[model samples]
Target: MRGVVLHAPGDVRVEERDDPVIVAPTDAVIRLSATCVCGSDLWPYRGVEEVDGPSPMGHEYVGVVAEVGGEVRDVRPGQFVVGSFFASDNTCELCRAGYQSSCVHRVPIGGIGAQAEYLRVPLADGTLVATPGTPPDDLVPSLLAASDVLGTGWFAAVAAEVGPGKTVAVVGDGAVGLLGVLAARQLGAARIIAMSRHESRQALALEYGATDIVTERGDEGVARVKDLTDGLGAHSVIEAVGTQESMMQAIRSTRPGGHVGYVGVTHDVALPGMDLFFSHVHLHGGPAPVRRFLPELVDLICDRRIDPGKVFDLTLPLDRAPEGYEAMDERRAIKTLLTV
Candidate 1:
């Protein structure tokens, strides 16, 4: 088997590795059919996030089950499945309460990189959700999208309570934020404002359901959002970029009693207590509890209500994942899909 490994910053390679096997009763082995490069993967690739030794690299995946442990009954061999980045025993108190990301037995599903021929999935019954049989060839990308970005965007919309009669603002024009606009529209948001300086991404955002596009930066961006909302600010703001600037933009663009649903993988960011206190805005975000929304999102995709896979502007072979990283880091691609 071959998997992606990061030997150090700015160095990603495809190396031969031993295949994974079921190690626990709740485990399952999957042969990846499709995988992708996430924005967070760039942190290590760009040398922002330190990497000591060789480490496996992907978290979003969609594949066919190769083997299942004795205790894994819900998922079986030969079934196509999609799973969240975090593995959890879905029956835990937190999971039962719809917060699988904080499950008592939660396990970070990072060891077996999805950009590989085969990998192991822990807590199969609780972590993996089987799709409606094998989907059409074109639907594979959409199903793979549901494994992470789509679900995260959907969670962001739900967190912000985006629905009919509300104005929503989305910061960050990355894949997640673009899909957040789509999710907001699907959730019934009357006005969807997408803040992006890139013309290509802004175009895609419009195609996905953005009611307006604002190509402003920093404070100007916040002012544009407020101006569009008649100085009251948007009722809900989705922060998909986890930088300090993006976070502040999200908080400042939202109305006093509005909510900020942030799903960006935070890095080196510090929130100002006084600013938040004075703003009276509600903040909620972390690793998205994707499992909680998996069932509904799966149904929506299966029934053709949404096509989040459109975000993948470039596709590459698994062996050429380094190119995918470069394309994203250079801003040449919005999202890259790797076929196994």
Candidate 2:
């Protein structure tokens, strides 16, 4: 099979790789229909995250089940499925408590690298969720988003405790943040303020239900949120950019007792303990337990209730995976969908 590997920063390639096969009784191998470059992928591409050697890339995916191991009774060969970056036994104590990403038997699917023709998912029965049926071509991207970004954004909204009559302020304009706006709307946020500098992203944020857009960033951005909320900050804030400035901005943009759902893979952010002690705000986030919401998100896509696929503004063949990474790194595209 052909797959993507990163030789170094600013370097990505498509190369021949060994095909995946079931190695565990609870594992399943799926032939990918589509995959994509995530914003997080930029971390290593730009060298913020170390690439020790030729590292395989990608995790978001939607595909057909090519084969299943003996213990995988929840899905069968020939069924279409979507999964999370982390594979977890959905029956575990943490999973039952809605924290599958932290399940006791969790496995990182990123290690398998879905940016290829085939991927081996362990603990398959609990990790993979099938769509109502094979989704049409038009719905493929949306379903693919559910595999990661959409689910991550949805988890952020839930963590923030967004509710009816509350205001949501999202920091960041990447796919996750933009979809955070959408999730906020779906979760009943009465007013959503999307902080973005990109015109294209701002437009999509409005389309996704942002009631307001703040082009300012940093301290000015927080002040803008306060200005829009009568000196008080938003009722909920979603921090989708993992940076020192973005994290502080999110923390300062919410009212006392408000919630901040941060889902961006934090790079090197450190919060001031004294500030946090006095902020009187709630903070909750981490690697999203996408498996917890895959079923609902898949149903939403299959039912045509949401269209998160719009986040993928660029599409390329598997061989052009390098170009996909370049476009996203340069911000020429929000996300790139790779055709298998």
Candidate 3:
């Protein structure tokens, strides 16, 4: 099989690799039908995250189950499934509480590399959500999106408490943030503000249901949001870019006693205890418990109620993953879908 491997900064390659097989009785090996490059993948490609060796890449995937371990009864072979980036037993105490990403047996799937012909999913019964049927080619992208970005964005919206009569602000124009805008809209946010400098992204955000767009950055960005909200700030803010500046912008853009749901992978961000206390904003985020929302998101996509797949502006063959990574890194593509 061939898959993506990251050797160093700006160094990504498609090369031959050993095929995956079920090594655990709780695992399932699936042949990937569609996979994509994630904003988080850029962390290692750009050297923001340490890479000690040529490591496997990719996590978001939708595929047909080729085989399932003896212990995996719910997800059978031949079922089309969408799964989270983090595999979980789905039966753990944490999973029962809706934090599958922090399950006692949680496993990060990136190391397994979904950008390949096949992937071995641990906790198969819990991590993988089977679609209604083999989704049509048209619905594949949307289902794939549910595997990660859509689910993560939905979790962000829920954490932020986006609902009817509330003004919501999304800080980040990436795929996840755009989807967060969509999530906010579906959750009935009365007003959705998207903070983006790129015209293309701004357009997509509008199409995704954003009522306003703010191009300013840092303090100026917060001021614009506050101005729009009559100096009280948004009722809820979703921070999709994990940076000190973006985090602060999100914090400042939320009204006192409002919620801030941050899903961006934190790199060098550290919040001041005093500032948080004074801000009086509720902050909740971490690796999104995508598994908790997969069932509902899958239903929404299958029903054609939402079209999250629009986030993938570029599609490439799995073998051309290098180009996919480059396009996203250069901001030439909002998101890339790699077909196998």
Candidate 4:
């Protein structure tokens, strides 16, 4: 099989790799139908996240089950499924409490590398959710989105407490942020403010239900959000770009008692305790427990109630993953879909 490996910063290659085999009673091997480059992947590609050596890349995937261990019963060979970046035993206490990302035995799919012809997923029953049927060809991209970004965006909205009559602000306009706008709308946020200087992203934000667009960033962006909310700030803020500036913008855009849900992978961000304390804003963020929302999101996509797939502005053959990564890293594409 062929898979992606990052040799160093700016070096991503698809090369021959060993095939995956089930290694645990809860494992399942699936032939990837689709996978994509994630914003988080850029951290290492840009050297923000150190790479000790050649590292397997990519996490988001949607595929058809090829094999399942004896213990795996619900998911079977030939079923199309989607799984989150974090593989968890949904039966665990934390998972039962809707925090599958923190499950007792959580495994990161990124480390395993889904940008390949095949993948071995642990906690098969808990981590993989089967679609209603083999999804139509047109729905594949959307289903693939549900495997990660869509689910993460939904988690961001939920964590931000977006709800009826509330004003919501989203920082960042990446795939996750764009979907955050969609998620906020679905959760009934009365007004959504998407911050992005890119016209393409700003247009998509509006298409995804953003009522207002703020191109300003940092403190000025925060002020614009406040101005939209009549000087009270938004009731909920979703921070999808994990950066010091984006984080501070999110915190500052919310009202004193408001909630800020950050789903971006934090890199060099260090929050000032005193400033956050004085702000009186509720801050909550981490790896999105995407497993918890997979079922509902799958339903929404299958039913054509939402179109998160639109986030993927470019698609490439699995062998062309380098172009996909470059497109995203250069901000020439919103999201890149890799067809395996």
- Backbone clashes (count) for model 1: 0
Candidate 4 residue spans exceeding 4 A from truth: none
Between candidates 1 and 4, the one scoring higher on lDDT is 4
Provide the TM-score for each candidate, comma-separated.
Answer: 0.98, 0.99, 0.99, 0.99
User: Candidate 4 at 115: error in angstroms?
Assistant: 0.2
lDDT of 1: 0.91
lDDT by residue for model 2 (85-155), tens: 99999998999999999999999888889999999999999999988878899999999999999999999
The C-alpha RMSD in Å for every predicted model, in order, reads 0.8, 0.7, 0.7, 0.7
Q: Candidate 1, 101: how far from true, in Å?
A: 1.2
- Supply candidate 1's per-residue lDDT for 184: 97
TM-score of 3: 0.99
Q: Quote the lDDT for 313 in model 4.
A: 97
- What is the per-residue lDDT of model 1 for residues 1-340, given as tens digits with 9 covering 90 to 100? 9889999888999999889988999999999999999998898888998887899989999899999999988999999999988898999889999999899998877656877888799999999998888877788888888888998888888888798999999999999999899999999999999999999999989999999999996899999999999998999999999999999999999999999999998798899999999889989988889999888888888888889999999999999999999999999998899999
lDDT of 4 at 204: 96
The pairs that clash in candidate 1 are none
Backbone clashes under 3 angstroms, per model: 0, 0, 0, 0
Cα lDDT computed for each candidate against the true fold: 0.91, 0.94, 0.95, 0.94
Give the alpha carbon lDDT tens digit for every residue of 1-340 in model 3.
9999999999999999999988999999999999999999999999998998999999999999999999888999999999999999999899999999999999999988888999999999999999998989999999999988998899999999999999999999999999999999999999999999999999999999999999999999999999999999999999999999999999999999999999998889999899899999999998999999999999999999999999999999999999999999999999999999
**Candidate 1 wrong stretches, greater than 4 Å:** none
Q: How many backbone clashes does candidate 2 have?
A: 0
lDDT of 4 by residue, 89-197 (tens): 9998999999999999999999999999999999999999999889998999999999889999999999999999999999999999999999999999999999999
